[model samples]
Target: MKIVQISDTHLTAHGGRTQENFERVVDHVNNHLRPDLVVHSGDIVIIHPDDAADRAHARTLMAEFTAPVLVVPGNHDIGEPGAAPWAGIGVTDERVAAFESVWGTGHWRHDAGGWTVLGLNSELFGSGLGREAEQWAWIENTVADLPATARVIVFLHKPIWQVADEPTDHNLDIGESRARLLDLLGTVSLAAVGSGHLHCYRQTRRGETLEVWAPATAFVAGDGDTFAGPLHQLGIVEYDCADGTVRAGYRSVPGLDDVSATGVPEVIAAITALTDSPVG
Candidate 1:
């Protein structure tokens, strides 16, 4: 199965060149590599920006997808500190609700190409742990009931562990929210674990699981120092259900004067190359 993952397109009414770059990325995805599914890992807006309008715009963009587009909320998509109506309620709930209203609960389970795919909301304080616990229970029960040979894939908004300069948010601390799921998934012959939030990309292996983090489709966070490089990137990952393996490729759009100082298309290309491996 071919899946494209994009994240952190912080769009806003304050038009900028970055927005155009985002559109370019979108157009590229739709025109060339037609993915079976597109997974957006959040930060769809700049900051609330008239919630109604912002959300409408977000939905419209997502609707352009030729395949199913799955989304999860990001810290920016909700609101940052002192950011207005959204801030009043806490970013977690408001942002999550906004996403759910347009895209349905950012979490669920389904069958994809004979493989089980599970989406979990790891953005913290949104659905609350109790709700998460319930989802966890459901996932555990569901997986346990499935045959031992089932191939499973997991998706989330935040990387379970930090890579490079991206700090592990309190919510996604591998010791916390991700731990339960990881433990339950330990023996599941996981095809891959995909996530975003870290604008920088990285991939690793843990036993039989392949954890892949997709880069941002928007701008890259300035990492204070040692962060000088073009940042715009989008990932296309292909998974082989028959053997539980994933390979991904990426491309960088130019003319992004708003951000991305270095071209990162090679990053995407490199990740996509992993598909040749026997991950399952």
Candidate 2:
């Protein structure tokens, strides 16, 4: 089975280069590399979590893909939640509800080709919100209910790795959440844990589980990021799941630009936009 993973679209309502880029991705996935499934890891919107127009736009754009698409809420789609939430906006039940109103659910599970593919809301961890525990329980139950010998694949938005010794807002994993999640998945036939938010493509192995960071479909950073991959390339990840294992290959669209995130005006505006986002 082949799966295409796209992430960090950061699209606006009216339309911008980001939307154009995502559309290119959709066309590429449909025309060139037809995959069994498409998973948009997160960051479907520009910034505001409660931006109904952006959410609606994302839904419409995502529906263009021929294969079934499963989405996990990104910090941009729903507000961020951690020691240092982005723009002081944190994930809340209402923000989560807003995301679900368009995307149906913040998480989902699909049993496909001997693999149990699962999506989770990463922002919910350490959120201290009402739905945090609920998502945790759902995750535990979902994994527990899977077949004893079933291989599992997990996807979420923010990465759960401790990449730096000085964990800032960029590298924050919210304390023991990573260990807690890994421990729960330790019970399953874990194959790969896919994520985005880093805006670059990278794959690494932890013990036996593969960690894939899908490249941002939108743009790279011109001014550099506090904790970002050195490669400023933009693309997607194609995962080939067979032989009881998975191999990930980075794929870029034919004409997709390796533009900078700061060069995009829409993205900068989004970073400074205010909202009644039902978050901190």
Candidate 3:
């Protein structure tokens, strides 16, 4: 099975050059790559959490793809848990509902290509919401019920850890919940884990699980300072899965190398700075 992973499109209702960049990506995937499936890791829209128009526009753009697409929520699409509200827009039931209204459920399971692919809502990992508990139960049951020999792959919006054990507040990775999720995942026939939020490409192996991070179509985040080497490059990840193993590669889209510096920093700062209270 061929899977194309794209993330962090950050489309706005008005549409701009970023959207144009994404259009090129879609055209490339359709014309050249033509993968079996497309997985959008998250942040489908720019920061307009309360605007239904933003979600609608994003949905319209995603419809252009030929292959079936699956998505999980990002901080921008449904706001982050414990994140300060931008104009009273944080991760609320209403925001999640709005996202689902356009994109279907924030989490789900699909069986394809001889692998059971699970998509989780990374924003809800420690949100303390009722939905969070419900999702946890669902995940536990889903994994528990899978056959022992079944191949499994998981996708979410944030990386579980930057370093193996140490924790950092730089991104919305699972902090307190990491151990439990890792334990749960450890019991499965895990092939790989894929995510997108850092706006860079990274691939690592922890024991048997392959950790793959897909870069944003909208922009790249860090330069060499934040993430070394080609990891900081703007690109998407392509994975070929067969039997129980997965092989992955990064594909850079032309004309997007400088777009992040030119178009995204200010908005990123504004969204990152918003919080109801300071988080330690």
Candidate 4:
């Protein structure tokens, strides 16, 4: 199957430069790429996880795509997860429920073409909530029982690692659950893992798995990078999976302006108003 992976659209009904760029992404996917499926690696809305209008606008914008879309929840969609989540916007059950009410299940599995594709809710990784435990249990049981010959691919909002010792909260490594999740995945016939949160694009090879970071369809983090890392321009990732192998590539579409979160004044103002933290 041909799949296009888009991430971090950061939609907001209020003042949405992100949504304007995202509509270009939608147009590109519809008229040019024309993939069989489009998987969004999350951050579907900008800050303010409680904003229903943002989520509704996101849903409406995504409807422009020609193919079916699947999504995983990013920190912006369901709040951050650690004990010291950014600006104290930690993930909660109510926030998760609200995310699901619009985006459907943030965790899901689809089987096709000899491959098992899994979408995980990254906001639940270390949230210490009942739903987090439930997701872990499901992952354990499901991952353990995967067909020995089936090629597996996992998609989530947060990555498992980063470049060398450069640490960033943009990944699951910030949580204590990384080792366990990796160990479980290590046992499977993993083919590739895809993620997006850093608002950047990168790739790494771990044993037999290809880890790809799909860049944001929204703005690059730039000066607003609460969690710092490489800042790449906006784009998407494409994957071709067939038989038991997958090929991945980064595609930078046309007409996407390169700017930081400052490009959207409303997003910056929301962060300051809600979290009492200025754009760092």
Candidate 5:
């Protein structure tokens, strides 16, 4: 499937430089990439607890997505800061409610072109709030429904594993629920895992699955810091389940230029390499 992953848009009704850039990114996705399916990892808006106008604008921006956008909630959108003490609480629930009011289930699973797509809510899992059990149950049932020959692709807002020691509390470590998820995934010939909360693109080998950390569409976060301006990027990942091949590439928005000048090509190469390697 030609799947494109974009995240952390940080949109707003009050137009700003970021919103303009987001529009450009949306146009590029619609006009250029024309992906079969689009997934936004989370943080579709700049802030949580938005007013009616803000929510309406967000819905407008999301509507620009030409492909079906399977969305999840981010810390900023959902209001759950896993490590940041000052970050507000109950934001995850409210953000998810808003997302559902506009988009629908912040977490779900479906089948497309012989591949099983699973979308999970990481903010809820990290915040210890909202529909985690229900989502988990749904995931179990959905995976069970897939045929044995189908490839499984898992998408979540927060990554289950980190590429390196670049520690940030935003992503779940190899913890209990994460481990359980991995264990369940192990039963299947998992294709790849995609997540976007960290901003930087990262990849790690876990058993037979390749966990890919997708870069954000709005702003990039450095390996470990929040305040550092990481850069602006929009990314895409294409999966060929018939041959178990995956290809990833992305570009900077507004300008809609590829990031080959930076390290993005190398990231894409790494992701594709995993798809070629025998499942170990």
Candidate 6:
């Protein structure tokens, strides 16, 4: 199956150049790449997590695509688990409901192209919410019932690992749920884990699974200390899976300014500070 992955569009209700950039991306996907499926890793909207207008606008934009699109929730769309609120915004039942009311569900499972593709809400990883347990149970049951030969691929907003083996307290990683999730995956024929939260594009292989980090179509993170991979670029990741092999590639959006050159040091600083803050 041909799949195109785009993340962190960060669209706002008022609309701006970023929205235009997203339009260009949809056009490119429809006209040039023409993938079989489009998956958005997360962060479909910007700033507030419960803005109905922003959510509506984002939904409208996503509808422009010709291919089927599946999405998981990012911290921007639904607040991070155990983290302090950003400007009084945090994940709540209402926020979760609002997200689901528009985007269907935060988790999904599909059997296609000789693979079982699963998407989960990373915000619930360590949230301590009732839904978290429910999601975990669902994942366990879903994976447990799959055949031993089934090829599996998982998608989420935050990654399970950032550096090699060291674990950080950052909310962007899966935190306390990492061990359990990894153990669960150990039982399956895992193919790839695709995610987007770092606002950069990176591909790493951990044993047989491909770890893909799709770049944000909106803007790349500017902080150098926290983000070690390529930054300040806007793009998408394309993956082709057939039989049992997966091939992936990155395509940068043309005519877009990198975050560093956009002269938004204060915006970048705010994001970096918010993400770096300790979980409350």
TM-score of each: 0.74, 0.93, 0.89, 0.91, 0.78, 0.89
Better of 1 and 3 by lDDT: 3
Instruction: Give the distance in Å from residue 70's predicted Cα in candidate 4 to where it truly belongs.
Output: 0.5
Candidate 2 Cα outliers beyond 4 Å, as residue runs: 171-175, 226-230, 275-280
Runs of candidate 4 exceeding 4 Å displacement: 162-174, 223-231, 275-280
- Residue pairs whose backbone atoms clash in candidate 3: 84-275, 84-276
lDDT of 1 by residue, 245-280 (tens): 566445555444434423334223322433343122
Clash counts for all predictions:
11, 0, 2, 0, 2, 0
Residues 1-280, candidate 3, lDDT per residue (tens digit)? 8899999888877677668878989998999899998999998887656668778988999999999999999988887775543355557788788888889998999888578889999888878888899889988998899999888889999887653344344444756677888888888998999999878788888889899888888877744224554477777899999867899899977667545544565455445655433323
Question: What 10-residue stretch in candidate 6 is worst by lDDT?
Answer: 261-270
For model 4, residues 1-280, the per-residue Cα lDDT tens digits are 8889999988888746787788889899999999988999988988878889989988988888999999999888888876567666788999899999988888999887778889988888878899989999999998888989988899999887543365555444435677888898888898999999878887778889999988898888676453444447899999999877889998888989888888787678777778664323
| Deviation from truth (RMSD, Å), model 3 | 3.5
Candidate models: Cα lDDT each: 0.60, 0.84, 0.80, 0.83, 0.63, 0.81
In lDDT terms, how accurate is model 6?
0.81
List the candidate 5 regions with Cα displacement exceeding 4 Å. Answer: 49-52, 81-86, 91-95, 126-130, 163-176, 222-242, 252-280
Which parts of model 6 are misplaced by more than 4 Å?
A: 83-88, 163-170, 224-226, 260-280
- Candidate 2 least-lDDT 10 residues: 167-176
- TM-score (C-alpha, index-matched) for candidate 2: 0.93
Sorted by lDDT (best first), the order is 2, 4, 6, 3, 5, 1
Better-scoring candidate (TM-score), 4 or 6: 4
